[model samples]
Target chain A: MRERSDDTLETPITSMIDIVFLLIIFFVVTAQVDKDVVDESITLAQAKNAPAIDAVDPRSVTINLNKDGKINVALQPMSISQLQQLLLAMRTQAGSAIPVLIRCDYETQFRHIDRVMQAAASTGLYRVRLIAEATGG
Target chain B: MRRKPPEQLNVPMSSMIDIVFLLLIYFIVTAREEVTEAHLAVNLPAPGVAKASENKPQMMEIEVHPGYLSVRGMRLPIQEIANTLVRLGKNDPDITVLVKVNLSARAEDLVTALDLCSAANLNNLNVVTLK
Candidate 1:
């Protein structure tokens, strides 16, 4: 009787490992580590009419503008002229149609955003995207 | 009484699987919670180039202030701006909405203005810094 109970207590290791491996694969694919890194410090504006971006362009440059008139590109703070030079280099590499996404803080002033816009315009990037929160604040 | 089972030499798969499951759960819980974000597409006027449209459309100038917005010299609250745009858009589909953002205006105010324009289906939008 004890032997039968011990046999039943043995865990099905092979099947458990199989399920674990499958779950790992699912997570790995869904995580999408290649997607653009979002800055946690920026508080984006909430807009109801804004269109949802299903898939962000991998080549697009994300510019984060904080409330203090500071600009962050890839988590590194940069000046307006530096931003312009970076944008120009990107345009030269990816052509004028290269996308630009501006992630401006909700409390930031318009003048700071204007500077970023001017920089993009100088680089021949006509159309740019302004990011907003998906839901109401 | 059952005889003691002979010890078999093999890898400890059960404990390893237990550790793997723990790690997976930890990752699933500690992963960054990404806040879904949307975007509003804007067109910036290229420098040194004039608009080539043969027939210029009627333009509505809207100024964004600190807490309110002024539409064509008439000051209006943020909530009422959408209705005004809708009424104007219905009158003329080709009307261009020119947004002059004040230096003191918050970015949220500009976004609210643009959102209202979009809600009114006013596609021809031009935003410039108010001098």
Candidate 2:
């Protein structure tokens, strides 16, 4: 009977280490963290033929709505009156008409959005825009 | 100390370069280079028809409620709304009109308001839902 050799051969560790490092770098650089920050709970309505709006300036203000029908600016809850005042102040400071964008959740009530629109209108901010996700169909 | 043989010490530079290039390309392709602009936080209503052409700029927003239709907050009748929008369009040829309807608002009321806008020659109309 022939005896088998008992050499315990181990795999080279540096190559595995290098591959793991590359993967970490790839995710760190490529992951889209900003888009994820924009709340995904809101399922924007589909437009059969909505034009793509690219290169939106940062001067625009964003309002976020939750399912419970609450309005928040940059994640802070605000009343219609407060939003109106804030917009007015922004207009004054910017010296140019600042565009207003509303980001409401799909489950939000219609009246809640109406109030916000009314508030913008009363404040003389007429350049109001609504944001929705694009649909394939 | 005795040095190791050249073959044993050799590391494949070409393979390492290829891997590095692949990693660079992957990151460059996946990164979000452009800053995403923030939009209005409203859940718009889905439209039955295709969106109108973007030949004109949106100038007015008409909101429909259960009992009344308001243009910029002032309650007005369907005919009055048409007249008002026509006047506004005449003043600004590049006028875009947005009609936001409440979910509970009657379909007839919404259709009437839309008809008024269309009759006024406001072709650039968009229907949206309130958040």
Best candidate, TM-score-wise? 1
Relative to the true structure, candidate 2 has a C-alpha RMSD (angstroms) of 12.5
Question: Residue B29 CA error for candidate 1 (Å)?
Answer: 4.0
Alpha-carbon shift of residue A108 in model 2 (angstroms): 2.5
Candidate 1's docking class is acceptable
User: What DockQ do the predictions score, one after another?
Assistant: 0.46, 0.11
Taken in order, the candidates have interface RMSDs of: 5.0, 10.6
* Model 2 stretches astray by more than 4 angstroms: A1-33, B1-131
lDDT of 1 by residue, A47-72 (tens): 88766667988899999999998998
Q: In lDDT terms, how accurate is model 2?
A: 0.61
| Candidate 1 chain B lowest-lDDT run of ten | B47-56
Q: How does each model score on lDDT?
A: 0.81, 0.61
- RMSD of each predicted structure: 6.3, 12.5
Q: After aligning candidate 2 to the native by TM-score, how far in Å is the CA of B89 from where it should be?
A: 12
User: A76, model 2: CA deviation in Å?
Assistant: 4.0
